[model samples]
Target chain A: MKKSSLILASAGALLLMAGVYLAFFVAPDAVVRIDDRELVRYSQKIFYFHVPVAETSFVFLLLGGLFGAMYLGTRKRSYEQMSYAAVEVGFIFVLLVMITGVLWTRADWGVWWEWEPRLTTFLVLTLMYSGYFVLRSSVQEESAKARFGAIFSIIAAVNVPLTFVAGRLDSLKPVHPTVFTLQGASMEGPMLAAFLVSMFGMLLFATSLYIMRLDLLRAREDIEYLKEELEVG
Target chain B: MAAGKQVFAIVKKDVLAELRTKEMVIAMLLFVILAMVVFSQAFGVILNDLDRVGGGLLWVAFLFMSMLGLNRSFVHEKDEGCLEGLLMSPIDRPLIFFGKMLGNLLFLSIVELFAVPIFFVLFRLELGASMAGIFLATIFLSNVGIASVGTLLSTISINTKTRDLMLPILFLPVIIPLLIAAVSATGGIMSGEELTEVYRSMRFIAVYDIIFLLVAYALYDYVISE
Candidate 1:
């Protein structure tokens, strides 16, 4: 397992390096409108790393929900740990999404923040997931913490779609430019390659981080269990 | 006969206790009235346009009032450790959820009933084109959503170190969709817009209420037992 993880880690790094090169020098800059004026933009470059990482983060969020449901079903501590790790990794990626989204919004909309659907929903998602961590930390008992956290995760998962739907229906903001639909131009070969590489790199990164965190949590739990055993003896 | 008596006993105990102390009602009412006063001060300069902000203020008041009431509802159980006894009872955990949610809904409705009149008098704004029945329906449905979700959350928060503070932290984000729906519905009524325009929001609230109520009911056993 260690050998496999090391391989995955190195592959993730290598793919990321390749993606960076492709994004910077290989892919063409797609034209975009800024403030009703057409601008040839280079930060369209951010999309390669940005969209893939954002997509990966959402995948982790759903994985967290899946593990949460599993934990509830099996009453296993390991599943809870995996769910917690996924949420942590998911949060880091969510931060990246927000940062990259801000840059893109500024480049395209000429505004730092817009209460648009995607951005607003992402903000709410970030908040909802952060509350998950808060809920876990606020409780002291291990069983209670696990139970509450699992329930909350499932509830948050259920709400995520409702939130998206609500935002879509309620948002008065106009839909902005999207990469897939810009002038009916599809992603060229190099751009598609870079996007896929970045996505694979992100998936690998998330996997390693999840395993590392899970190991650390298990170690901590083991030590706590030993202490309890010692005191009982 | 025995089951009916026990359920009534639980309900009567809660109601009698509430009547005697009036802590939950008074605290929630005072908090909401204070909020309204603050709103009046904040919007004093816009008195001419008070109608525009009136709907928002009404919902804001309800939101904060619900928060306060939710926090208070569990205080007695936590203070006296009576919640442990309740959990040990043969009655199902979901019943506790329903009992508490119904109690909260009753208190919240009472507060809203008083608040609407006070709000109208303070703002001196007519109901305009709002159908009174629609407005009442909005209040009824909104309270169910709040109480259902709030009951479970308050239970979760009671076990936390922050207890009261954690309730809103854990609750507000989950409840935002409901709030948006409510505000839009109220806004539709206030703006003299067609009810059809607010149907989407109302439907969303109904869906939210059903989903959360079911989830909370299913999960309440795990929550109280552990």
Candidate 2:
């Protein structure tokens, strides 16, 4: 591995460890006093990790869109591969967000799921990208697969925000807390710190995974090209 | 003007072809009516919430019916190598997209005109003239969104190994927001709710139609190209 990636991997590992510790121990538990008993929402701790993973997923999906557009403009396989890698890593994070999110929902709301804006949009998003992979596979030709995948990614990207808006429109009564906002006014103090730590840590982890996957995919593509050349020659 | 002519020519060709065979439209009509029959059986006969679920049922049928229409839209073109010929022509690519999308919109509207009445009769629902107008408006806007996206996706699906099977897999998730808005708008119209109640959904459908049309138009060149 390159020294930069090695450093990145180590840094990601350290920050992730620190973030998890801070999430559990350093960050104050949300406590409720009821009937002479102290009730704590341990499930709320999942929020720190879940929000970070979800944000990282969005960032990577956007990166996939960017790379997809680049692939179309240049017709370069490299950009397509990078976009695919980003989507794959992003999808992993999306699954994590859902798992952790469902856990939190079950704990907090006493249901396995809620049709809140974010949750519904996430479901749409997961399906959209899953369809992306499905579309990719159903195409037989390599170039056609890349082209269709790129176009689909761009469409999916544009739809993401629209889905968010529509989801928000229907969710007049949101079960999820509006912790982070565009204006950035809601959360404060240690909660904010913990969130930031987890956010950056998860982002770093996601980036490292994307980079690693891209490298592996590129190497595999190179091997396949060489084999094809040998067969033709 | 040249692009307009090309678009019209393509639309005319598709319409004439459909007029000759009438396969796509008939299939869509039957599929939708059958779906309505099934839903009425489930909701009207068994559960007895046909009124409550009418909007959902309508949009669901519309979505699947449009999927069927779109999946078959490019079949004759692909089978006859007509799509390849179209691509080789000097016509601009997005114009091709608009042509196909417009053709789809026309056919979906025809199916809707037939299906809506049958739908009401089957489900035993009543619609005033104004309510019918609102309902048709929702269908039109939703159709625009569906046809625009569906046309783009069907082009890609035509090139895929699974052909028509890939269309719904790619189309459904992408159409969720439009579906939500359309279903809500239809629900509002069906319940005789205030225009304000359906206003947001109507706006959403319109906006979704415009955005998806533009995005699909912009991306059509890449998809139709080799």
- Evaluated with DockQ, which candidate comes out highest? 2
- What is the DockQ score of candidate 1, to 2 decimals? 0.67
Q: Candidate 1 residues B107-165, lDDT tens each?
A: 89998888887888877866744476788788889899899889898989988998998
Window of ten residues with lowest summed lDDT in model 1 chain B: B1-10
- Tens digits of per-residue lDDT, candidate 2, B37-109, equal 7876666564366555688888899899998889788887899899999898888877999999999999999
Q: After best superposition, candidate 2 residue A86: deviation in angstroms?
A: 0.9
Q: What TM-score would chain A of each candidate receive against the reference chain A?
A: 0.90, 0.92
Query: Would you give me the overall lDDT of model 1?
Result: 0.82
TM-score of each: 0.91, 0.96
Per-residue lDDT over A1-233 for candidate 1, one digit per residue giving the tens place of the 0 to 100 score: 46666777888889999999988888777777889998788767878888888888888888888888888888989999988888888889999999999988898678989987778778888898889999999999989889888888888877777777777666355475566664753676888888888889989977887777788889999999999999999
DockQ-based CAPRI category assigned to the predicted complex of candidate 1: medium
